[model samples]
Target: MLTRWRWFIAVAAACALPSAAQACSCERPSGDLHTQLRTARENAVAIYRARVTAVDPAAFDGKAAVEVLEVFKGPVKPGERLDLPSGGRGACTIAFKAGKEYLMYAQGKDATSVSLCSRTHSVTPGTESELAWLRTGKLPPLPVALQREAVSCEPCDIDLVGGRLIVAPDESPSSWLWPPQAAEAMKEGRPFFTRAHVDSEHSLIVGMSFDGKPFELTQTHEYAAPSACTRRIHLRWCKRLDVTTPAGSPHPVFKCIEPGESSLQCDESKGRESSWRPPESIPADACLWRTSDTALCTLEPRMRLLPAGARASPVLKCRPQDLDRRDRNHFCQVETKPGPTDKAP
Candidate 1:
């Protein structure tokens, strides 16, 4: 149930990874370069084919992002969280509230409430018709225990194993998911929040609101039970990504998303640190960024490739293709067509 800003422009280009996070089951301090490879071989991740039934406008915030729904996986309810392998806000948000919705808009430097989704679909970054959503469906399927309760918090605990760190909410935040769970008897299909109370230790569950916090509870030791055996949950982090895990340690996890196509190809760039080639699924004119060193990439928009040896070297050394197409004479123009939507004008 994560969200972020999106570009509406229609150009053919790839985005550079802004930063990264570690979401893989095989996250470790030493890390494994062959982890994704091995995971794919064992079908650790499933690649599903989906088309853009619809898309809402996108907005950018300095922090996280949010988007609307056009087409989606399963019947997305209100407030349900949705994400693609590329790692950005979703097109089909779980609606502000079931049927209620909002538009993505930039609030100065942060991507915050700008407007609500129009009664009639409005113009947006990508063509609503051609927008294709890419994400892992039920990557870690939820346990049946969570589906039974309408208001519940699936445990979001992290544990380290096999030289890697594995972090997942008990059943994946059953009560407070952005797009909400796919289907269940009791489901609070809305974005979850962190509600804190100083005076009263009591916390109330509520729907998503830009102005009001979601589920705020005092940070006191409410469930102070004696430690049952000491279990350590090791984590990894890309200090560069600007993201911190609740757990003391941090890690980097990347998701490759390509719009309107199958098979995400995240090829490591020949000469760059944590950089790679944009797969064939994203758009040419899409705005994307990696908030952490452990982020992801989504390629799309009719293959705006390197025109048969356009230029071998990168202008910005692993930056957005639009900005780093080291073709010199055409460098500035590279990022011209499909730069980030929030890119400073």
Candidate 2:
């Protein structure tokens, strides 16, 4: 009887084991590349191209520091350092190696993180379309049927389908204020003039610092659709105070005013005064001095945060037994290296 019971237990255990093929299968993701891009953008708080600059091999978690290469879809500027906290050896881990370029789609606005399940992957061939759209503010075409069906509706101030042909949602907002250093100089009464242009209800305010820093300012209103419609509606309202520059030259040149001076003369040729107002929500006395507030002021209007309820499904899940399984089923082994098909056109 004891022998019979042992045979029965062995058979039950064998039946419970998953077939090798079943353990490795993954359901293909839906949507084309553009759709995936839209989904990724909607799900990520930040996205950018960067190179891993340093890694902490001794840390308990896989931690790394990366330098920003391009400002694709984050509140980060080029040259900023991003600290990543979760990587290496988990179902959702991204094994970041030093000296590699990656197109990272990160989550969390404050403490940023990424995973293999994310749209984040190593930069490779055929990926040019996405980056091109980022640099040039161009939108790729969608399927004809989906295009024709999605028209601008009342609830959707901007229709996603029809809007893509006209608006480049990924474009960054034109800077409307000089950098802090330059602004500080102007506040101290520096004598300088700038040529300016206004377009699509937006204007570019340029200036130079006493130390030769260039100030490029842009002020524009952004609009977005409430739902899947790509057409955008007004996201925020911006304002600028009227002020004219000190006299001289044919073009409008903004000049810094003395501490007590309320106004300055403009050049007979042409002069205008422009003062970029902080967002209504920000405190008036705040200044840019080694803090994230500066980036928030710059990238918030421009950085596309994940929308209300979008999800990116993971391709793999590591079970308890799969933890140290360094073989095919191990989650950490699934690396997305750029292949020939990944090249940009």
Error of 1 at 305 (Å): 4.3
lDDT at position 31, candidate 1: 15
Question: Where in model 2 is the C-alpha error above 4 Å?
Answer: 1-29, 58-60, 137-345
RMSD (Cα, Å) for all candidates, in order, is 23.5, 27.0
Question: Model 1 over residues 243-273: C-alpha lDDT tens digits?
Answer: 1222321222121122122221111222222
Best by TM-score: 2
> How much does candidate 2 score in TM-score?
0.33
| Model 1 error, position 54 (Å) | 40
Deviation of model 1 at 94, angstroms: 19
Off by over 4 Å in 1: 1-157, 160-282, 289-297, 300-305, 312-345
Best by lDDT: 2
Tens-digit lDDT string for candidate 2 (1-345) = 001111111222122221101111111223433545666677787888999988775212658888988876767788888888533322234557789888787765542667544566667553555677667756444211100011122222112222222223564222223333333445665522222432212233444433333333333312111111122222211122124432322222342222231221111112211122111221221111111000001112222222334321211111110111231111110112211112111
How much lDDT does candidate 1 score?
A: 0.21
33 Cα displacement, candidate 1 (Å)? 31
